[model samples]
Target: MQKPLLVTDFLDRARRYYGDHEAVVATTGERFTYDEFGERADGFAAALAERGIEKGDRVGVLDPNTHYHLEAAYGAMQLGAVHTPLNYRLTPDDFEYILSDAGVDAVFADYEYAEKIEAVRDDVPTEVFVTNDADAVEGDWESFDEAIETDAGFERPEMAEDDVITINYTSGTTGDPKGVCRTHRTETLHAYLVALHLDISDDDVYLWTLPMFHVNGWGHIYAVTGMGAKHVCTRGIDAGGIFEAVAAEDVSYLCGAPTVLNLLVDYYGDHGDVPTTGDNDVRVATAGSAPPEAVIRAVEDDFGWYLSHVYGATETGPLITTSDARRFFDDGSSARFGVKKRQGIGFLGTEVRVVDEDGNDVPQDDATLGEIVVRGNQVMDRYWNKPEETEIAFSDRIEGYYHTGDLATVDSDGMIAIRDRKKDIIISGGENISTIELEDTLYEHDAVADAAVIPAPSDEWGETPKAFIVPASGDPEAPGTTEEEIVDFTREHLASYKVVRRVEFVESLPTTATGKVQKYELRQEEWDDEDRMVGEG
Candidate 1:
C-alpha cells in the first residue's frame, strides 16, 4: 500500500468506479462521462507518444478554461511528462522566453492564443504544435480532435513521488518570469487540501470560472475529478455566460478573482438578479487579492451564494488560507461580511505564520504588519533552471518556510488580514504585474532619468500600476518624454495588462543613501485614504 503518489490515481479512480457519472461539459456543446473523459485523455497521451513524447519531456498548454485543457493536463501527467502552463495574457516575447526556457517539446493551444505561439514558434524549441482548431491555425500544427480520435494504446510509465509534474511561471521579484516547479507529491497533497477546505464532494457540480493555467485552476482538476463531480467548462468570463452556465448546468461551486465578482455584481445591478437556490447551493471561492466587503455581502446576502476568500501565490499551490466566515461566526448576521473578509486560518496540512523581519512572530494585535510565510506538502519543489532563486526561497530566514512576499496582520481571533504586498506586485484584474519589470522597461526610454512603480486603487480591477517618472531634466512637459510617449513605449515592450495605467512626472524620486528607491513612500501617498488596501479589499 506504500506505492509512489501519482497524480493519475485521481483520474483512475473516476474512470474505474464513476464511469457512468457525467464528468465534463465543454463549451462546444458536448458532454462526456468519466469513462469517456478517461479514454479521451489516454488517447491524447497516446497521440503525443506517437509523436516522440517521452518521460521528462516538457509539454506546454495554452488555452482558456475548457474540457480539452483538463484532458491535456491529465494526459501529459499520465505519460510522466512535465505539463507547463503558459499565460495567454502575456506578450509574444514572454511566450518565447517561457517556452524556450522550459524546453517545451510540444504545445497544445487554443485558436485565440495559438497565434501567439506562432509569433515565436520559429525561435522556440517546441517540436510539435497542436491546436484545438487546425483550420484556424495558419502554420503547421496537428489537430487536437484527430489525435484524440485515434485508438493507439498508451503505456503508463513508472513515475516517482518526487517527479516534477507541472511548471508554473510567475512574475517574481526579478524582471524576468520564474518557473515554479511543482512535483506530483505537491499536487496530490494540494488537491487533498482543496477537497478538505472547499468541502468538495461527488455531489457538487463545479463551473470553470478560473483559468485552467492558474496553478492548474488551484489544483481543482484533480480534486473535482477524484470526487466524480461534474465539470461545466466555460470559454470566457462574461457575466451573461456565467449566469447561463449557473442556470443550465446547475453549478454548485466555482472560483474567481474579485474582478470577476465585480462584473457579476455590476451585471446584476443593470440586467436582473442572481439566482441562488434555483440551481444549487452555489458556493464561490475568490482569490488573487481580497474582494471588497460589499461584494462579499452581495454574493452572500443578495445572490444567496456563499463566498469564501482564500489567499496564496503560485509558489504555494495558490491555496493556503480561506475566510469561510459562517463556519466561525453567525450565518445571517450583518457583521458576517466583515468577518468573511479576513483571510482565515490555513487550510488542512498547510502551515502558515506571519513574522517580522527577524523571523519572530508578530503580535496578534491586529495592527502590526508582518510577512506571511508557508510550509507544507502543497508547497513547490523549486524554480526550474534557477538554483539561486530556489535556494533563496527555501533558505528563508525563518527556516523551512516559503516567503509569500505579502504583508498581513493576524487578529486575536486568528484571522489574518493583508495590509500590503511586499514584492512590489500589482494584482490587477487577477494578473500579477512586476513593478521591477515595469521600471526596467521605463529605464529603456532615453528621456527617462529614473522611475518607480506602485499599485493604485481601482474600482474595476483589484489594483492597477501607477508609474512615477523623473524626466531627464528637459522641458517639463513640452520636449522630453510625455506621459503618452512613456505609455506607448511600455505597451510595445510589456504586456497589455502590465502597462502603466497612470503616469506622473516627478522632479526626483525618493531614494536611500545607497540609491534605492523608497517605493513605500509612494505607496503610502497613493493609498492615503482608501477604503480597502489591495485593489478593492
Candidate 2:
C-alpha cells in the first residue's frame, strides 16, 4: 500500500513518534512538546473551521517567527486552507494589493501588526481577524489564544498532493506582487531537500532567525519539525538577542540571508565568545545576496561556524541550489571555499541550466553568461489569480522552463555563478555592467558594509551605474567618504564603464522582508518620470 505524502503526514509522525520531544521554545520563554504542538495545530484547525474556513480557502498570516505563527500555518494546511504568509514589513498599500490579489478569507495577525491589517482590512473581504495578543488587538479581531484553547480537533481535509497549500507573494519591488501557489507535493519535496542539505537530525536544535512568512521560513518549519528537532524562536533580529538565544538554547542550526549573516559576523567579531561550545558547530545556511568571500571566510575561519550558501526563489520552494563544497574540496582552503560561494549547482531533485536568448543551453565556459532556468518538484504550480502573468513567468522567454530572470555563467567544474538579474544589468554606452560583480567587489572593501548597484538615468551614456552604500564602521552622522572617494575605489577595481558614477550614502538600503536589497525600487526612483528606460522594444 502506498502511503500518501502530505504535510499532515509529517505532523502526525512527529506527534506519534516524537511526542515527548521539545517542539517549540517561544520568545516568551514558553515551551511545547511535539504532542502539544500537534494538538494546538489541530485545535487551531477546528477553530478556523468554526469561522467557516474550508478546503482551498486562502488564509493569511502576518506575524514574525513565533509559536502561534507556526501553529496557524500548520493548522491552515491541515484544514486544506491555503496558507498565505503576509510580509509584516510591507506597507499598507503593498498589503492592499496582496490581499486583493490573493482574495484572502481570514487573516491571523500578530498584535504588533494589527494596525497594518486593520488599515487594509476594509480593502480586503477577509471575514475573520485573529490576533496573537489580546491587549494589543484592534478592529474587533478575535484572540488567537482563545480560538486555539478548545481541545477539539477538526477532521483533516482530503487533499491531493497537487492541491495548492501555500500562496507566497513575491516582494513587489518591480510592480504589483504576484502570488506564487505551491502544492503539497512541492512543499513536501522542498522540506526533504532542505533536511538533506542541512543534514538535519533529531538531536539538532534549530533556531528561527529567518521569518516564517518568508518561503515558509526557508522551508525549515517542515524540515526540522519532521526530524523532531528543537525549535528556538526569536521575536526579532538583535545582536544581543541572537547571542543570548544561541547560548541558552544551544542552537545547532539556523538559516538567514546574506544580510543576516553580515550582521551576525559583525556582532560576533565585536562581542561574541570564540570557539562555539565543544565541537557543536553552529551551521548557518544563507541565500538571497551571495555573501562576499571575506564574509564567508570570517564566518567559518574566524567564528568557527560552518556557512553554506543556497540560491532559489519563492516560487521554487527556495531550496534549489546548495553549495556543498566541503564534499568536493577536502582541502578546506579559502580559495576552494570561495569557489563554492558562487551559488554552486542544483539540489537533488532540481536541474539547472544556463540558456542563451534563444533558449539554447550555454556552454560550460566560465565567461559565457546566460539566463538561469530551473525545473524541479519545487517549481510553483502557478501565480494565483494571474494566468497571463503566470504563463509569462513560466515560459516568457525560456520556452518550456521557468525563466528565473537571473543571469549566470557555468564554470568548467559545472558550478553555476550568478552574475546579475537580467533586468538589473546596467548597459552604459554599449558597455554591460554586471551589478553583482560590482557589488561583490565593493563589498570586499573594509569601509563598505553593504552595497547595491543600479542603472541611473544618464544624458550622455544613455544609462550610468549608481552605487548605494551602507558603511561598515561609520557614524550615521558622518559617513567620512565623498563621492569621488567611492568612485575612485570602483575605478581601481572595475573598468571605467562599470564604475559607479553616482554614490548615495544611507544608513541602510531598502530591503524585502526576506533581506534582499530592493534594487528595483532604487531603479524606479532614478528612472521615475522617464519612459525611455522601461525596456520597451
Candidate 3:
C-alpha cells in the first residue's frame, strides 16, 4: 500500500487503463496512443541504458514543445535519472553553461537545435547525443526514431518520493540561471494541484502552446497525461495555428502567459476573427505575470475562452495560487473582472501569505505592500549545486516559509495580488510605485497593448515611471499612440504621484520565453549612466 510516488507512474496509470486512448498529437504529424507513447519512452530508456546511462544520471533535453521532448523526459526519469530541460531561447553559451552545470550525461535535441548542442558538446562532458534528425547530428549521435524501436529490456529502477527527479533552470535575470531541484513528491503533488484547480479531465483536449521546457509546461504534461486527456502539440505559437488546432483537434483547455494571450487577441482583431462555429470551449490558465483585468475580459467576451489566473515561481513548484472564481463570476456581477484579475489564495496543499519585513501578516486593506511567502508540498527543497542559495531561498522572515521575492498585497477577500517583483518595484521620490499597476492601466487603453513599465533616472524625483508599449495592431510598421496621449490617459485613472512621467513607444518589450517581460534588461539600459540606479525608499 505504500508505493513510492514517481512521475513515471502517470504514464504507467495511462498505459494500464487508457492504453488505447490517443495521447500525443505531435507537431511532426505523428500520433501515438498511451501504449505507443510508453513503448517509445521504454525504447528511449533502453537506448540510454545501452549507452551506459545509469540511474541518477542527469539527462538534458534541448528542444521545443514536441512529443520528442515529452518522451525524453519520461524516458530519463523512468530509469530514475534527472531530466534537465534547456531553454531554447538561450544562446549556445547558455546551453554550454547549463549542460555543463547540470553535468548532463546525455542530451536529446531536436533536429533544428542540434547545431546549438553540437557547438557546446565539446565543452560539456555529455557522453550520449540523441537527435530527431540523425543527418544533422554530429559526434556519434543516436537517431531518436531508430532508438525507440529497440525493446528496452531493463526493469524500472527503484525511486523514492523525495528523490530529485527534475532540475528546472530559473530565468537568470541577474546572473547565471540557478537549477531548481524538484522531487518526485513535489512534482506529483504539483500535478495533482494543477489538475484539481483547473478541473482538467479525460474530456479535455490540451494544447501545447506553452513551451515544454518551462517548468515542464507548468506541470500540465503530468496532469493532462494522468487524466488521459489528448495533447495537441504546436511547435510554435501563432494565432492562425492556434485556431486551426482548436478547430481541428477540438481543443478544450490550454495554458499560456498573458503575453501569449495578448498576441492571440491582437491577431484575431487585426487579421480575422476567431472561428465562431467550432466547438471551441477553451479554458486558458495564465501565469508569468498578473494580466490586466481588460485582458481577462477580452479573453472571455472577445475570444470566448474562460481564463484562470494563477501565480508562483520556479522555486514554489510553480502553481501556488489561482483565481478560479467561477461560481462567484457566474452571477453576472460587474466586479467579476476585478475578482478574476487577483491571484486568489493558496491552492490545495499550499499555504501563501503576504508579510511585511518582520514576517508579520500585512493588513488586509490591500494597499500595504509586502513579500509573498509560501509553505507547501509543491515548493522545491533546494537549488541544485547551490547550498548558499538553497539556504537563502528558504530564509523566511517567518520560520518554515519560502520568501517569493515578489511584492504583493492581500485584499479583504484574501485574494493575493502581485504588485511587482522586489527588484522591479519603482521607488519614485519616497513613494512606492508598482510597475504592474501602471502597466495594468496602460492595458485599459484600446490602442495600447502588451505594456511594461520600469524606473527611469529622473533628475529631480530620483526615479520616475516610464512605459514601453506594443501597439494593439501588433504591427511594427504602424505608428503607436503619442507619449502625451498615454500620459493623459494614465492621469485620469491613477493619482499624480503614481502617474508615469515618460512613455517610450517600442514595437515590443523584451520578454522571456515564458511571456514575462525582462524588465531588468530595460531598467539597466535606462540607468546605465546614472550614478545610482534604484531610487531610495
TM for candidate 1 is: 0.80
> Which digits, one per residue and each the tens of the lDDT, describe model 2 over residues 1-537?
865668777777788889998899988889999999988888889999988999999999988899988899999999999999989898888888888888899989899888987997888878888998867766788888889987666787788998889999887777788899998899999999988987999889888889899888888888888888888988768766776677777888888888887887888778757434333568888888788887788777876678888899987888788777666675466676666577898999688889898888889998888998889998888988789977887786576578888899888878898998988888888777799989988887777888899888887887888888888755535666677888898899987778888888878899987889998888888888798554321
**Root-mean-square deviation of each candidate, in angstroms?**
11.1, 1.9, 1.8
- Report, for every candidate in turn, its global Cα lDDT versus the true structure: 0.84, 0.84, 0.86
Cα shift from native, residue 65, model 2 (Å): 0.3
Q: What value of lDDT does candidate 2 attain over all alpha carbons?
A: 0.84
Give the clash count for each candidate: 1, 0, 0
lDDT per residue as tens, model 1, 400-500:
89998778889987788876667566898888676756876786787875678899988888689899987766445643867788888999998999899
Best by lDDT: 3
Error of 3 at 433 (Å): 0.7
Task: Assess the local accuracy of residue 247 in candidate 3 as a C-alpha lDDT between 0 and 100.
Answer: 83
TM-score list, all predictions: 0.80, 0.96, 0.96
- In model 2, the runs with Cα more than 4 Å from the true position are 151-153, 272-279, 473-477, 534-537
